[model samples]
Target: MLDFAKGPILAIQEFFILAGQAVRNVFRRPHYGADIALQMDTIGFGSLPIVILTGFFSGAVMALQMSRALAQYGQVGRTGTVVSITLVRELGPVLTALMVAGRNASGMASEIGSMKVTEQIDAMRALGTDPIQKLVTPRMIATAVVLPLLTIIADFTGMFGGFIVAYYLLNLTPAQYWHTVWTALEWNDVSQGLLKPFVFSFAISLVGCYYGLQTTGGTQGVGRATTQAVVVASVLVFVLTFFITKIFVGNVVS
Candidate 1:
């Protein structure tokens, strides 16, 4: 007489156990440097162009919107600060997480899930190796380590994007713009934003890896896992982002 209402609770319990196992798997190996390096290159280096482009456009749009809104009250100089703050604090990490989730999370999941169904993961397990250790661990370590660094780059590029829009497109004075940034910017704001991405990375990577490890059937499983990995990871990222933002902002939102 199992209660259908309690089925989800069992699932959540299983998920946490897997999560603990995944964490142990990620750290149990002797050397993961190569995998880590590859992940950094893929998530950080390969993602630069898009991060820059999106960041730039976002900044430009923010500046435009803020400018138009502020112009009515003659607060044009404040527009630079507004855009800068928004980009550095909110847009940078959230957008970067979204990008990484889309670009790497799904791919990692599918690659692992595909390996799983193809008996490759099984072969590794049969050979006295932990599949979680061999596969999931590497991705988890890579994502956890690389996310903060990627966020730093994203933040810089995003600010530069705002600068581009502010100066070239909006014709705001460079001196004035820089001054606004200097005066309005705080280390807490920057650090708070950057900090969230590291956690976000873990959520995406772990969920992605978990789904991959659980994948079954065949090519269809891989496809479903890939799609589900992306959706689930992205959703988790946003959910975590909301909480992280609140904590960083010191419950200021509420």
Candidate 2:
């Protein structure tokens, strides 16, 4: 029992420590501009289409289900309002984070794990490059920057999807749907909507790098790290989502 318990406890400690180091490196000297640019392209541009598709479908389905529930109260026209709020405040950021975690986190772990298993990481250290600075910091910075942008795009796409459903299936005029969505959200809502993604971005990349760096047992270990990164990052997105919501919304604990 103690061994089982200690495993997760140690892992958690290592994760936070790694995250702290990465955070400090982000603002420090010897910044790897080229690597950061490449990672931004790899993480942000590469993940765009899937994030858009996920957002669109999520909003459409939200509209479908919410319409039925609100219809009983004769408030089906408010679908846009609810969909916009839900997407911007929760679904957009959370789902985008999940998708990125599934796609990019696994890739991060696999790539780094492969290097670790093959001793390439040791070669970097031999040449006096800090492995953490060269390998991990760039990824951490790229994901933190990219995920928020993706979340913002997802929020807009989701709102657009909701707009389409409202315009056609629900027979709402385009003007009415647009108006409701815009009016229902304020600057406070937008700020809160964005905060979750920023936090999630850090969690996903840090967890991926943490697991990747710890890889062992050769090829099989790389595979295991990849899978574990995805699972852990994805779970963290949801867990962080709740606490973030509670903190920003400020009524959950009360």
Q: All predictions: root-mean-square deviation over Cα?
A: 2.2, 1.5
Structural similarity to truth (TM-score) of each candidate: 0.91, 0.96
Candidate 2 per-residue lDDT over residues 16-134, each given as its tens digit: 88888888888888899999999999999999999999999999999999999999999998898999999999999999999999999999999999999999999999998988899
Most TM-score-accurate candidate: 2
When summed lDDT is taken over every stretch of 10 residues in candidate 2, the lowest stretch is: 245-254
lDDT value, residue 193 of candidate 1: 75
lDDT of each: 0.79, 0.91
Question: Which prediction has the highest lDDT against the true structure?
Answer: 2
Residues forming the 10-long window of minimal summed lDDT in candidate 1: 24-33
Mind giving the per-residue lDDT tens digits that candidate 1 earns over 1-254?
Answer: 56986877876676678779878765565656687788778777887787777777777778888888988988987876887788778887788888888888898889989998999988988888877766767778888777777777776676676777778867888888878876777887877777888789888888788778888999999999989889988898788878877786775555
